[model samples]
Target: MLVDKVAEILAETAAEVIEPRFRALADGDVSEKAPGELVTVADREAELIIAERLRGLLPVPVVGEEAVSADPSLVKAVCSEPAVWLVDPLDGTGNFVAGRPEYAVMAALIKDGETVAAWIWQPTTRLGYTAELGGGAWRNGERLRRAPAGGGPAALRGVVLSRFMPPDLRTAVDARTGGIGTLAPGSRCSGVEYPRVAEGDQDFTLFWRTLPWDHAPGSLLVTEAGGVSARLDGDPYRVGRDVEGLLVAADEESWQQVRRELGLRPVDLA
Candidate 1:
């Protein structure tokens, strides 16, 4: 089974710490970790819970958002380890501090740079997604499978759009269909949208930048749920030090159609 029970613990603990402090105050005591990055008590506390749990459960190593940014080698070593965990205790800290319920607790187990198991939990929504290599994906206790996307223009059916997408890409997408419907879900919540792709709620996801922790867990869920998960270049995605890439996941036909529409290349499928 090879599932890491500690990941479940991390998700549960992170959710517990996050929901209460989401919008504890208007001030929210926000701080800057980098020029453009933001942080809060919730992020640090959640990371602490996840990192401690990983240190106890795994003999390898962990790469977390809050505590390890100062040490690039730590991230590199963990990403290169044959077995490691990529964690984003609070994926959408900015949204959390802004009183949004879209943030989530994300964890993924990687072996040989490939994701073996993943869990993404939204504490406020109480929706949890989990996937094991070949066990299929599940939400709560029920298994999930991709639903049909009607053979109409993608834009007419409320495609979940990405924020700050380049103008040319948006135009090309819109030209292939009608105006995209208002279904753009934010990425602040862990791996929420990946399951949405599996559930047929979100037509596709286009990410210009996604770290190991951001996509690892949810990508497994999407594929296990009878959808496709791969880089924009259509290559098998591998988690590594600061490796950022684009992804698109959907039902087989729609996935292919979207890739063609976007002029994307195919990856070697497993």
Candidate 2:
């Protein structure tokens, strides 16, 4: 499939441009996009490479994290385009920059407000995940099924965005997860977290920002893997929409459990 070929390019890009620079960034290889938001030479190079290659695969518009960050208008363009490819060349920049092998390359295909395809590749772990809209998800080409239910507070594990929330909401959001489940050490990279949940290593993950490049691919991965995802408000994850947040679980049952425990209002997935 075209998506798989894109993944190959990403994996190769990661090997050539991203991995070599890991923990060995030069004086100018790193810079601040804004305080606490980092960008590296590898990210810029990788995206250009991916975008250029994707254009060859199809004429659709290609929007990347770095590109969209520089031009907010691109965000609008993406929202209105018939189809667009969204890329996060290197997620978990913090982890990658800090010498951790936690970042990844992610891409999603959005058409008519829906994400129909996604690819996420974790280079260090050599784990690759892909999903086609109606088809089930796969890891290294093996079919996947999210972990089955049973564990409650003691066995639960997931991602929580409270720490990244505003001061007022942070405390409340953090408290909401208290005692409900353990949070596995996050990669700080949706590329990893999204797959972790879908693969059943984690039970759920909540994000405060539903950026297309970040959540778009992962949302499809979790959902197609037999999990469920939506805005905390019960809206299904839609590409190109700047949503407040997202909640994904191994199953709808777990999704509701987490929402209720957090004191969030619930809506039926159907």
Give me the candidate number with maximum TM-score.
2
TM-score of every candidate? 0.83, 0.94
lDDT of 2 by residue, 121-169 (tens): 9998999999999998999999988865556655677878665555766
The worst-scoring run of ten residues by lDDT in candidate 1 lies at 261-270
- What is candidate 2's local distance difference test score? 0.84
Compare the candidates by lDDT and give the number of the best one: 2
Model 1 ranges with Cα > 4 A deviation: 1-4, 25-28, 148-152, 155-190, 241-245, 263-270
Output the TM-score of candidate 1: 0.83
Candidate 2 is scored at a TM of 0.94
Pairs of residues clashing in candidate 1:
234-267
